[model samples]
Target chain A: MKQFLHSGFVRLAIVVVMAYVIVSLCGLREHVSILSGVDESGTMHLVFGLIYILSYAASLVLAPALFLAAIIETTLSKVNVLSRKGQEGRRLGCSELRERQRLRAPEHAP
Target chain B: MKSRLCISAIALILAIAIWLPLLHLFFRPDIGDLGLEKGVSRIADQLAAHHLQIWTNPDLRNRELAQMRQLNPEWDFMSRTFLVMALASIALRDESRIPQCLETIDLVIENTLLIEQEDGFQDFLLGYGYADNWKVQPPKSIFVDGEISLMIGARRMVADRADYQHLMAERIGNMVAQMTLSPVLSAESYPDECWVFCNTIALAAIRLGDVLDHSNHSEFLREWVETAKLHLVEPQSGLLISAYAVDGTPLPNGPGPEGTSIWMACHMLQVVDGAFAQDQYQRAKAQLGRSLLGFGYSREWPRAFAGVMDIDSGPIVPFVEASASASGLALLGAAGFSDKKYLRQLMTSLNIAGFPTRKNGTLCYQASNPVGDAVLLYALVQGPLWEKAK
Candidate 1:
C-alpha cells in the first residue's frame, strides 16, 4: 500500500480524483443549501442541479489524462546513467568540510 | 478495503462530474410564467437578489463598479441607466414598492447626470479618448446623449418630477435633430462618420419622441432605415455594421457586438420601428444567442465573424460563446418583443452564473453591471411604459 502511494502514477491520479471530489462536494453543498431555501428563487433547484451534473460529467473526461500523468511522473524519475559520472565530480559532505578545516588549522598552528 | 476506497473515489469524482452542471437545471426559471406581474416577478426577484447590494452597501457597490469600469466605463454608465430604467418599470409593475425603488433610481440618476455634467461626457471615454479623437469637433458622443435621454425619460415616466420631463424632451430633441442633419440619417461619434449602433441610440430617442407625440419625427425614423439599407447592412449577414461614414457609405468592416452600442441598437429599434425592431432582434438572436442545457447566453459575435474580447463583451467565457455585453443587453430583446422563451433562458443563465443576491426586497447581480441588471429589470417591466406612452 505504501509502495502504491509512493508511485507517481498513482499520486497523479489521486490528485485528480481528490480535486474532483472537492469541487463536486462544494458545488453540491451549494445546491443543497439553495434547494433548502437559503436563496430568493425558492424553486430554482432544477437549474442548479443541471449545472452541477454537467460539471461532474466534464470532470470524468479527465480520467485518461490522470492515468497518463501518473505514468509520466513515475517514469521520469527512474532513468539511470553510469557510476563513472559520479567520480567526475568531487563528492563533498559536512564531515569532509569539517575535516579539511581541522587539518588546515592544525598545520597553521604548528 | 483498498478496492472499496478506490471504488468510492471514482464514484465520488463521477458523481461530481455529473451533478455540478445539473445545478444549472435546478435554477432554470420557467420561461412562460415569469410574466412581469403587478408584483415583482420571479425574474425580477432573481435580478434584485443581486441588485439590492448596490443600494444597501457603498463599498461593495463601488468595488464591483470599479472592476467593471476597469473593463468598460460605458458599463459603469449603462449599469446606472439600466438600473434606473428597471426601477422605473418595477415601480409601474408594483405600486407598493415604488417608493423604495424610486429612492434607489433617484440616487443612480443623480450620480450619473452629476458625473456627466461635471466631468463632461468625456469622463466615460476609454483610455483611447485622448489617444485620438473618437468623435468630431472638440469631443462629442451621440451614445452618451441617447443613454442619458433614456435614463431621464425612464425617471420621469415613473415619478413625473417636473425637471426630468423637460430634460427628456430636450435630450430627445437633440438626438432627433442630430439624426436629421446627418447626411444619411445617422450621427457620428467621430468626424462625420455614423454607426448603426448610434442610429439605434437615436432610435431610442425617436421612440421616446413617439411617446411624446413627435409624429413629425416619423420621416426621420424612415430615413434612418433607408440609409442603413444603403450603407450599413453587411452583405453576408444582413446585420448592420458597427459603424460607417455618414453619407450611406459602408465602413471597412461589419457589425461587432462587443460594445453597448449594438445591443442598445436592437432595443432602440424596437421602440422606434416595430417591424425593424423585430428583424433586428431575430438577426441578433441568430448571430449571438444560444441555449444549452436549458440555460441561455449570447456570443459577442456571430459564427461568421471572430473577434477578441473588449470592454463590452467583458471577460468572455470559453466554448459556450457568451459575452457579458451581449448577454446583458439581450434583456432588451427578450423583453422588448416579449420573447418569453428567450427571457426564460436568459434568467436561468443569469441566476446560475451572474451571482444574484436578494435582500430586503431589492435585487442585484454581482457579476453584472448596474446597467445590465437594469436592462433585465426593464425587460421585466417594459410592456406598459412603451404601450401607455405610445
Candidate 2:
C-alpha cells in the first residue's frame, strides 16, 4: 500500500485535488472576473485571479489525467506481478518434473 | 523498475489521449434545445434570474457596478442597456413574465437617467472622454444617447409607454442632428472619434423608434449606409473600420476590422440594412472568426491590422489572438445571422472557458462580469426583439 501511495501518478492526483479544494475554499473564484477586465481591486486581486485560473485548469484537466494515470499504473503493476508469479510457478513445476524423471530413470536402469 | 517506468509513462500518454478529446463534452451545452427559434433558453433564464436578483438587491447591484466602474464606466452603462434589452426580449417571448421584466426595466431606466442627469453623460464615459472638447457644443455622447434610446425603444416595443416614447424621440432627433453634421453621417462616441459599433447601434435604435412611433427614418438610414460604404470601410479587409474621425479619416491608431466592433455592428445593422449587415457578417466571419479543435473564437483584428489590446478587446489570447469581448459579441452575431454551426462552436468555447456558476436558480460566469453576463443573455434571447423590429 505504501509503495502504491508512493507512485508519481498518485502523488500528482493528490496535489491537483488538494490545490483545487484549497483554492475553492479560499473564495478566489470571484476574482476570475479579472479576465473580463473588471475587478481591478489591486495587484493581489490579479494574483488571486491567476491562481484561481491555474487551479481551475488543473482541476479540470490535470486531476482527471492523474486519476486515470494512477488507475492505469496500479492495474499494470498488478498484471505484471500476476504474470511474474505465473512464470515462476511454471518453472518450479518443470524442475520438479525433471527431478521425478531422474529418479524414475535410475530405478529403470537397474 | 525501468520497465515499470516505461509502462507508467505509456499509461499516462494513453490516458491523455483518451481524455483530451472528451473533455469538451462535459462542458458542451445542449444547443439544439436552447430554443433559439422560440421561447427562452435555459441559459437565458438562468442568466436573467441572476441579473434580476442583482437589480432587486441594491447591495449586490451596487457592488457589481462599483467593480465594473473601477475598470470601465462604460461597462456599467452597457450592462444596463443589455440587461434591459434582454429583459424586453424575455417579456415578448413569455408574456407571464412581462410584469416582472418591465418592473426591473423601469427601475434600471430610471436609475440610469437619474445618474446621467446628476453627473452628466460623462458619468458613463472613460476618463479620456473628458480630455478633448466634443466638436459639437453642449457635448453629448452618442454612446450614451444611442444605447439609452435602444433600451427605451425595446421597452416600448413590448408595450407602449408614453414617457419612453417622448424620451426616444428626443434621443433619436439629437442623434440625427449630430450625425448629419459629420460628412460621414456618423456621430462620435468620444470627441472626434466615431466607432462603427456605436453608430450601428444608433441606427438600430432609430429603426426601432421608427417602428414603434410611426416615424420615418428610412432615407436617413439609407444615406448612412451609403456613406459608410464610401468612407467608413477599411480597404484592406472590405469590412467597416472600428474607429475614424468625424470627417471620415481613419484614426491613425484606430483598429481596422476588429471583431469586437464588427460582430456587434453586424448584429445591429440587421434591422438597419439586412443585405449590408449580411455582407459584413460574412466578411467578419471569414476575416476574424476561427475554429480550432471544436472551439470557436474571434480575433480582435484581422491579420493585416495587428491591433493592440484595448479595453474593448479585453485580453487577447496569445497566438490565437482571441478577444474576450469579440468572442462574447460573436455569439450575438452568430445568433443574429442564424449560423447554427458557428453558434454551436462558439457556445462550446464559451462553456469550456466561461466558468459558469449556478446558485439558487441563478447562473453567472465566474470569469465574466455584469456586462459580460448581460451580453451573453442578450445573445441567447435576441431573436424575438429583432424579429419584432423587422
TM-score of chain B of each: 0.82, 0.96
lDDT of 2 at B120: 87
Q: For every model in order, what is the iRMS? A: 13.6, 1.8
Q: What is the C-alpha RMSD of each candidate to the true structure, in Å?
A: 16.6, 4.1
Tens-digit per-residue lDDT, B243-270, candidate 1: 6765656554434433244566776676
Query: Would you list the C-alpha lDDT of every candidate in the order shown?
Result: 0.64, 0.89
Candidate 2 lDDT (Cα, 0 to 1): 0.89
Interface RMSD of 1: 13.6
lDDT at residue B64 of model 2 (Cα atoms): 87
Identify the candidate with maximal DockQ.
2
Q: After superposition, how far is residue B312 of candidate 1 from its true place, in Å?
A: 2.1
